[model samples]
Target chain A: MPIDLDEALKAIAHPVRRDMLSWLKDPQRHFPDQEHPLEIGVCAGQFDQRTGLSQSTVSAHLATLQRACLVTSRRVGQWNFFKRNQAAIDELVRRLGEEL
Target chain B: MPIDLDEALKAIAHPVRRDMLSWLKDPQRHFPDQEHPLEIGVCAGQFDQRTGLSQSTVSAHLATLQRACLVTSRRVGQWNFFKRNQAAIDELVRRLGEEL
Candidate 1:
């Protein structure tokens, strides 16, 4: 099936989500050091600090992005590490080339 | 200058605009014959027929896409012909590669 462009667009519509994508571009600059931060992705608390939004709101936004397949998460112990899904991103670009 | 991802995303967020881009993909299939349709792009009336939207509403949607740099227009006598701007589309993809 073709990717749902509507859902993808809606997922990235919010300013905070857009900021999250921007921050993920350079995680070291936007997020704090954690154990194997580059290999493991940034933690949700780091996202909250970078965005300056409430922890709950950031958590919800990350959930939205994860559901939309824009980002991927890995649960390690108590923290959920979030990273940009390059495959999904490339798929989006490919679909735009073919569909748009 | 880098393309504005937010504005481009907002422009394509609408169903009609997305339809327009999809139609423009295969103009001959979606649009009817006109004087040099391929060279001149599809006219507003043909777009209205294909989309089943009111002429005024389709016109307005086309204008919105034009403003957002997603589409470009050419005036031919009394009718307006609109086509997808490939450069802008390519730029959007490029920005997505760099930014997102």
Candidate 2:
């Protein structure tokens, strides 16, 4: 549990990642309309642009979120769509509330 | 707010730090009797023994927690006593729930 907590905390410890989570919370508002369905989630390019960072950097950040179970990703053709994992975040908050 | 979140998350991201929080949850059970009152909190030497870490290492970890406002410390003679700041932790968790 500590290891999982460590991973989740480290994944969320960064400013960019924290900002990304906030943006990802309401992708429809933060990002431009996509041709694909919104339910599929926001693509990496949108995050890349908003972050003002390299695509690789944004991708790495997304991967960290995925690893921490804070976000879920889905591949759509050449693009990967990412969305917040609300359940995981809620559970993390609950655990942290209890533990901390 | 992001900077505060960054500090709080980074302070708690380490396993040792997280373990310390759990132990501090109930200092009476986790630590031996203090020559002083328990209300003052656990001394650094007790943490040093439990962590199996050097006193300097334990102190550094405690300092990070204090900087993040997750823990409070008081100087008692030659020793610094430390304990969890429940209100700050609750506030951080609340903010994280809202932001994340």
Highest lDDT against the true fold, candidate: 2
Per-candidate iRMSD: 2.1, 1.1
The Cα local distance difference test for each model comes to 0.79, 0.86
User: iRMS for model 2?
Assistant: 1.1
- Flag regions of model 1 displaced more than 4 Å: A13-16, A25-29, A35-41, A74-79, B14-16, B25-29, B35-38, B75-78
For every candidate structure, what is the RMSD over all alpha carbons to the true structure, in angstroms? Answer: 3.3, 2.4
lDDT of 1 by residue, A19-91 (tens): 8977887787776565555778889988777777899999999998888788889998999998998777777
Give the winner by DockQ.
2
Listed in order, each prediction's TM-score against the native is 0.77, 0.89
Model 2: pairs clashing at backbone N, Cα or C within 3 Å: none
Candidate 2 residue runs with Cα over 4 Å from true position? A1-3, B1-3
Per-residue lDDT tens digits for candidate 2, residues B25-69, read 898888865677778988988888898999899999999999998
Model 2 DockQ reads: 0.80
Q: List the residue pairs that clash in candidate 1.
A: none
